[model samples]
Target: MEHNKRFLLVHPEISRNKYNFAGIIDNEPLELEYIYSMLKSMGYEPDIWDGQVETVSLAEKLKSFMPGYVYVCGRTRQESFMKEYCANSKEICGSTTFVGGIHAQHNYKHFYEDSIDFIMTSFDMFAIADILCGKSLSEIDGVCFKSGGIWQENAPKPFDAERLPVPDRTYFYAHLDRYRYLELLPCAHVRTAYSCPYRCKFCYRNRLNCGVYSARSIASVVEEIKGIECENIYIIDDDFLVDAERILEFVRLIKKNNIRKKYVCYGRADFISGHPDLMKQLKEIGFYYILVGLEAVSDRYLSDYNKLSDMSCNISAVEILNNVGINIMGMFIIDLDFKPRDFRELYKWIKSHKLRHTAISIFTPEMSSELMEQYKSRLITDAPCDWDYLHVVAKPSNMSVKQFYFHYHILAAKLFIKGWREGIYDFVDYGFYIRTILKNMFGFGG
Candidate 1:
């Protein structure tokens, strides 16, 4: 038979828990769409299978499509599922399996298995195309592959944001109703930058692209935004509110182009607090939501994490966003050194600010981060899925694991009740979430 050129790109499903906030938020697999577009540009047929929204099983898809190549991408939380999908693809169709993403980039050794044929350490689409054209795997610079039953890795090249093609959104448009962000139904994702600029110790995003930051041209970003079918655009940058002049130009271009769209993005607390004028300009440009990382309410924790912002900045950020009528999704991190009183104090602080939309995550030191070395001695779990920030993966200094979970659950329950009463998250099923929380608290289905 002639060499098959069909490709199947998959997005793995996540483990179910209250922390997943499933049904509340299901983002489109933008990465797979990028791969799909690149493959199509190369004159190869490619299909996407998003496990979050797909009803059919992987086995069924593999049998039906009979693709010659299968590619899977996901974060650390989806590591197990990524491997499983590759194993299934190899077993069912004997397809060439490729695995890549943030997790695979940093920990390629974990995927050195017989089922996986290649591991991409960077977004080198041309290298992938070369492989499809019968080029030897050893010739690729940023990929790992088996040679004579031995795994060999090539040095990674620097990633260039300019080389990325505009992601084809045919799959997104086909399943428009399945993707959402809280109340923002049928939302779309857009990226203006690669990696992050800051050096927060616990963040893995800044470590991407070899710690280099690059932004696409403002004109190109605006052009892409104007073509999007959805009114809600989630600018999926690590921090969209980085450069004042750049952001001002973006706002100006949006107005000039007459492109009306609501926006969501990540921003630093210090930026929002210092540039109240910029915040006002963003609000005027239809900025509906900003997810600020108010990691902790204490100055000590901020300094320890190298966050470069104090609690005062966080307070001012909330006030500024509230005044501008922009919703603030405050993300907080709970440290292992927290005592029982600390959780109560954090809850009290959140309530005092009248912040209805708050996300509390346990501090998890990623395997790819520098903080992992410091926590290695105190580590509790080696499982990749347990590092999702929802699980306590390290020994606590002030409390036992059970005690820490008890306090954390209590805090989450309180916030959930407050959010429910205020009608902040009416789109999600309240009963279902409440049941999930209880089950996790009691260790029934956790």
Candidate 2:
């Protein structure tokens, strides 16, 4: 046990496909910020160096910080870098290395090497404090570690979001200008809730937090919003619009306190379509952006994915949001079963509806996603890193892999170009997006 130990939080560097604007936007690592605040409360000094935004080398930062413990957080895409950074940090400072977040939570078995010392499977700050305080590893719930050359893990305790500390945003505020969401530059992200309540077959959220929904109190959320110095606030909740009463309360509190900030949050089609009045109220209270998962245009496809909401619901949702003057960031999935006509129909629907902002990801069964088990044998690449949504990982049923990509490239180009011509995004962003698309199209691999 060490007293008053300094800890360093590292966000592993991972490359994103430059073709997508959403992929390239810099975002505050709120997860690490939460961990940092927890460590501080435990009387440990904590500092964060984000690989996505920081210019210094991890080794250089490690050397300068000379922390007794190094904690890394990342998704599956950044697994290799996480391992590498932890290994390097251990070499630099003999730091006890720990890993957490999505990659480590579900795939902790993959990280039980000598280089890594511990992995956190839950977001419980008390569990984390106990571990750092040198409590017996076996007794610490929600932590996985090796004892006497044997790997062990305790049963995870349920996470209560209400019990969590308000994330100390001092570090994030210093780097606020770097984070953006398309046109919403300098965006600050906060989550009012964790995980989604609805079971969408393709989502990996179930693995992240046992598919249980936990929400912070409205008063706490409003307090966080009021402290945000950034002009734009991005609510990273999986489904912020799920509870109509909660939404109404949040809006009421915001107006009551005179707290104002441009906002964005996720919503389901059914929720928006069913609650037009609330959507209007949201817009009136500075909610100008909403990211809706309009997975497909076909009701059968929606049924196949178990999206719960059908095409008509998606249409109504888009129309309602548009009518209220809220910018909709439509998200769609490109299934392997799609024929050329399906692509055409999807584009036609977008055009007919005049949908300006959109995100189209190939139906990727990312590691730990429920759909991955069914599509495992169908995967073209065994490389875990290729599971990023940018790649076509699964074998197409209706067409060859090459042909599926050919149509994908054309569809992507058309979507971006159309958006640009229609002035959905700025001209500076348009040039970068166009260039990235061209590079990926003619390049060796996407």
Candidate 3:
């Protein structure tokens, strides 16, 4: 509501599941919504254009809403292709386009001479207002812009973890049907806090954020929930149950509000093993599932990756969470170390215990992860993200790339069939899987 302040926030509609090469991937753009809400809090009028509805006519939105600036969040591996299209669209419409997010942030220098007027990292979205209101670009922090044919970099302004805004789900409200398992409600995503306490090597959060973490007050959260209409909320926090006391407070508030919605969130096994009561309470409050990064099943594999999750905790945590009747989506990374028996154990475990789903990703050393640094000398593919190489980037000391790729897909197909047999299909949002199967079996998705 700041007079004379207006912005058009664009959450580039990207392939929801990375493998989709055909249909427009329609998933909630949680990160851009966060920026939109922040702009609103700063008194700026903001409009959301979920690229899935149709190609963004930057010209149409600017002529209609007449916002002075644009804020966008795009991913690296998956949505990299859409960035240029969005920037060109914005330029064609005559709006100042400022881009942010992991890909834009890391490679701002790489794509400096385009329709992107400014490139930013995870935080400091508000400062963009300063740029649009005629303030000298020099005063704005966390922006990378061109001057005199050269790109100037400003220190990334801190992501105000404490003052984080509730994302504006209205952007995706009408188009909720495009997402996986979200047709059930006008689903929304909220972060209980900002930044993860741990810094895993292969994660952008670790490479970009600080060791310090911040949690939103339970009262503030309940107030935000009052305005959202969805019955199912996906807690997009890096780890929702990280703070046990805060979760307890959140659960109590939900009960008091008489809100009824199932929830899904990320959690760490060590933390869950330490506090079963929180998991139990979360389960009581419509918390239907938890996504835990059980990176590896063996201690050697986990220690090698610095994940700090052991096979013992993996087994125990799965059993405990299941005992509470809350489904677990165990994410496991397959490497040369995991043999055919390990594969059998993993599938058997999910089938026997009834896990919601599992992402058996053949470890692709993420952008700045330790795996990337460790294997950079021996990496087979170095291009930012071809998507095709997402399966075989990280070759184990023992296995061949072809071997890893073949086993990876074969096992994944088996797991999909297994989940289908058990009637547990909505667990993982792998639209890419359906697209791949269709392309081969029915000649579609390409």
| Model 2 spans with C-alpha error above 4 angstroms | 1-4, 16-24, 444-446
Backbone clash count for every predicted candidate, in the order shown:
0, 0, 6
Candidate 2 vs. true structure, TM-score:
0.96
Q: Give per-residue CA lDDT, model 3, range 129-230, as digits (tens).
A: 577566887877778888887889886745665576677777677666554332334456766676687766445555554344666788888788767777
The count of backbone overlaps in candidate 2 is 0
Q: Write the per-residue lDDT of candidate 2 for residues 1-446, one digit (tens) a residue.
A: 35338899888666654433443467788888888888888778899988877889999998898999888998776788888999998798899888898778877887888889888887675777788766877888888888788889876766877876778887777876577777677888888887778888888774456657889999999998898788899998888998999999999999999987899899999999999999999999999889999999889989988888898899999999999999998999999999999999999999999888888888888676557788989988866566677778889999988888778878899998898788776625556667877777777245
Give lDDT per model, in order.
Answer: 0.88, 0.83, 0.67
Model 3 residue 68 CA deviation (Å) reads 5.3
Q: After superposition, how far is residue 82 of candidate 1 from its true place, in Å?
A: 0.8
Quote each prediction's TM-score: 0.97, 0.96, 0.85
Per-residue alpha-carbon lDDT of model 1 for 86-179, expressed as tens digits? 9999899889999988899899999999999999998566667777877877778889998889999997776777777899999999998989
Any idea what lDDT model 1 has?
A: 0.88
Query: Which residue pairs clash in candidate 1?
Result: none
Q: State in Å the error of residue 363, model 3.
A: 1.4
Reference-based lDDT, residue 160, model 3: 60
- TM-score for candidate 3, residues paired by index: 0.85
